[model samples]
Target: MSERTHDGGVAVTAAPSPDESLPAADLAAKYGLAVSGARPSLVEYVRQLWGRRHFILAFSQAKLTAQYSQAKLGQLWQVATPLLNAAVYYAIFGLILDASRGMSHDTYVPFLVTGVFVFTFTQSSLMSGVRAISGNLGLVRALHFPRAALPISFSLQQLQQLLFSMIVVFLVVIGFGNYPRLSWLLILPALVLQFLFNTGLALIVARMGAKTPDLAQLMPFILRTWMYASGVMFSINHMLEGRPEWIVRVLQANPAAVYMDLMRYALIDGYGAVNLPPHVWALALGWAVVVFCGGFVYFWKAEERYGRG
Candidate 1:
């Protein structure tokens, strides 16, 4: 309303806004506004992740390709790296230290190589996952996609690298007299289970890394300790013989050892069915399902905080 003033000036009064009756929260709610970067429901988050599956796959492939881009041998290093590590282990453990006291040369060679390759899958996944968020902060901060994708894609990248190395694994096994047979088909399920387990582990570490960037520096020593305990270079059964049945069982049941045992059992003829932990398949399946689901939820619980400083 406008009114004439005593001299020549006019005064105007503003009308009330229609929205004055609504609180800010109610106004936002009524307009379908939400807090940016807020976490979705678990099921909805899973759907969002699934919606970005193609991005996940392409990102993994790109990372795998670039991993060896600067090396002279390029992708050959994927296989050669593990093979060389196997050779070094063979010289030290199989030759000098006599770690293969029970198994013959053929059995020991294939066993060592298989352990190196399988363990590398888990090792690389962990190393990559530990940096998945911290190493790619730009992407994490600029993008709005699921934060889990980075770690999951890194795990997938390691899985792809392992698949490439499997060619050499097959040659090593066949050269050692483990010809392909009906049981060889078990590699599929074993790899699937291992991939799930690796992905779960990756997700767990990614969340940790995002918060504690210093963790990236600490992971190597931790993984090295895990590798040694996992029997990557020798038979746990042989090394721990007489260490008490329960202790041996506990080490054998560790997820890393379990996956390596499954691969060795599937790929090598002389891996000895007798050495396998009881109910090995059940253990593998249980580890895969439990870790993957638990890690997914654990990571999702902190979704909104991932890219924050």
Candidate 2:
């Protein structure tokens, strides 16, 4: 380019560019630029999620608070909803079907309530997880935090609701002549393991739901079937009395059944260790660790695909 000098003579000059000889990739590297929504490494993703812990917690609390705000009973429905479910199950399974044949009324009532409350924890988690990503598309697209937070937050919200509902569980158990004891303390560990398991399951479903929004419509039937197979209203041992040994073992080993069995044994006086399959605690831990880790990795795998076309 030519420029006029003060002396009126034409001057030819050129400016040098540092990036003139570099390719696009090299230029991006030189400027420390990264793709806007590229997936991070697994370790980095974990770190990112950890850094956003406050957001996860706050979001969960906010969701939980707003969950029934518009209802007449508000949060009372959290406890009442499951209790009502227990009543219906008790009527059909306990009275009409004689599912509670072995257990007395005192034992059966608390048993059914505990099972309903505990299983609802997982059921709600999975249901919310299916909508976590798809339901919050606006937030996912508008924010840059780890997508896992959405599902994790929803799981946390369910856990919070379960904790609130447990007060009734305690009263029902006490009302049934099962007083507070050391074993009741076992609920803490059981709840923790269940939370881990639920969170993991939520992560898995969140990813699936994001890819196929129609999955939300189908989850209710799947969950209802799971509830029946989980022995929510009846004992697997009692109901499957004549079934094959392998079938009983498989049903007892199911994570949902395992968790419910643990809680029932811990809370109900009639549900002794004999009611639980061999190594029930070990099964609970295994399910929690396996599902939580697997779900985290599975959800993280599709991190970049969330909120995309």
Candidate 3:
């Protein structure tokens, strides 16, 4: 028998018998309940992810390199694909449809590229996260890496693509005499916030997708609708003129709209016009924290069952 402290009073407690199991901590490093005192908060969970940064970097590099392993184009496809996307959209929106008629931005191409590139990262992260666990059944069963690493790796891979797209956009901006401004520097922090948002979203979707494989199929459609709603192809402000002020306010409530607005403000408007107000940034950061904390706890609760199916 073992004696243990109790809140009400000292009580005698029986220890596990020889045939019974040891505490969870001794079974597996990954299986123990997070002690109340030592358990990680959402920020700490993200820091643990940061501590395993090498794994995320290695996995992202592997995925990117493997894309061209057998192909002649190799990694060139990364640049080629986004270049093609920009060209197609420029042709359709800038030339054929003349969609930028009354937009505040000077040129349409750079605007379109910035919107599409930034939005693509969100789309890819969510879509890939939905299948992260189920797609890695073999590794999930055989390895003990942090499950969050999977989605983080996927987000990093997409970030690589986003970086390439940014380079291309920069060159285009230079050619078009749209010199980058001091505000462009904000891109880095905006990207960090965007990454946090994606990571949190991936965690939530990954758990849901694992339980219901059908989520994988529906993600693309949801993303498509989300993109349209996000104002990626057009300016939201242009459509809000006749609508109720509350409707426009509600649209602004969408986090993606805030993100893209920040991008446009930084990349095209040169920062002064697009600088996020303190209130807006506070709101965005609040949303990110809520999503990340909510998703982290929700997903952590099911860590043990992720590998079962």
The number of the candidate with the highest TM-score is 1
The sequence of per-residue lDDT tens digits that candidate 3 reaches over residues 110-219 is 67777787888898889888888988889888876567888778878888877876887787766655787787897887787887888789989999988998999999
Question: How many Å off is the CA of 264 in candidate 1?
Answer: 0.7
- The lDDT ranking, best first, is 2, 1, 3
lDDT of 1: 0.93
Candidate 3 residues lying further than 4 Å off, grouped into runs, are: 1-51, 104-106, 270-278
Query: What pairs collide in candidate 3?
Result: none
Tell me the whole-model lDDT of each prediction, alpha carbons only.
0.93, 0.94, 0.74
- Please state every model's RMSD to the true fold in angstroms: 1.6, 3.2, 9.2
Clashes of 2: 0
**Per-residue lDDT of model 2, residues 64-144, tens digit only:** 999999999999999999999999999999999999977899999999999999999999999999999999999999989
TM-score per candidate, chains pooled: 0.96, 0.94, 0.80
lDDT, candidate 2, at 273:
87
Lowest-lDDT window of 10 residues in candidate 1?
A: 266-275
Identify the leading candidate in terms of lDDT.
2
